[model samples]
Target: MAVASVTYLTRLAGYIALRNRTLSPRIVEVMEAAPGCVLISVIAPHFVSDRPADLAALAITLFAATRLPLLATVVIGVCAAGLP
Candidate 1:
């Protein structure tokens, strides 16, 4: 597809451009943080909305995330969201 080709070319261009350069530590740190930032971006909409259910689930998940493992936090979020 055209989209896929464009995406591949775009990534290839970045790779070629950076091929001879050493990434700075700051850039590495930002790259490491990218996934978590993306995750927050995805979940952030739920936090900004006025829905009680989403707010409660986000609160429960945030609390559990601090005290529990990733699986437990996800389970708690799912359970909280499923509550009627």
Candidate 2:
């Protein structure tokens, strides 16, 4: 219960803080890129560890991301990761 309250209050505080503010276009563009940046941060270590499967998967996913839908990219990535 205490954890939940803290989580809720923190989120609420952020919402209240941003609710009245108007952000610039550049900030909004950066915000849009934030998820991909975070995802790369999380995945970079795995890529740097010299794992062939992960490298293959990332390559396949990158290619699919450019040519296919999100769901297809994910499916191809998972399949690539399972490759031996």
Candidate 3:
């Protein structure tokens, strides 16, 4: 098999293993990190000259309030982020 196919298979196996152990602390950490990173990225003046801190703050607040698992929020955020 090609290198890419091998890598994909390895990732798939890892995912299957991880899903079997849902709600792990490591996964929670990843879930919180993505929004914080996105919040920071959106706040950085260099990225947006206007510095929409208000919007970023609101988004982060809502994300925090959802109380959903990191994987769910991150997946939703990623999909929503992609749409626009």
The prediction achieving the highest TM-score against the true structure is 1
Q: For model 3, how does the per-residue alpha-carbon lDDT over 3-68 read when each residue is reduced to its tens digit?
A: 446555655665676776668788767754654564465435434435465455446545754987
- For residue 49, give model 2's deviation from the true position in Å: 2.5
lDDT of 1 by residue, 42-72 (tens): 6789989798988988899999999999999
Regions of model 2 farther than 4 Å from truth: 1-16
C-alpha lDDT of all candidate models, in order: 0.79, 0.74, 0.57
The most accurate candidate by lDDT is 1
> How much does candidate 3 score in TM-score?
0.29
Better of 1 and 3 by TM-score: 1
| TM-score of decoy 2 | 0.61
Error of 2 at 5 (Å): 17
Q: Cα miss at 14, model 3 (Å)?
A: 24
TM-score of 1: 0.65
Per-model TM-score versus the true fold:
0.65, 0.61, 0.29
- Candidates by lDDT, descending order: 1, 2, 3
RMSD of model 1 against the true structure: 5.5
What is candidate 2's local distance difference test score? 0.74
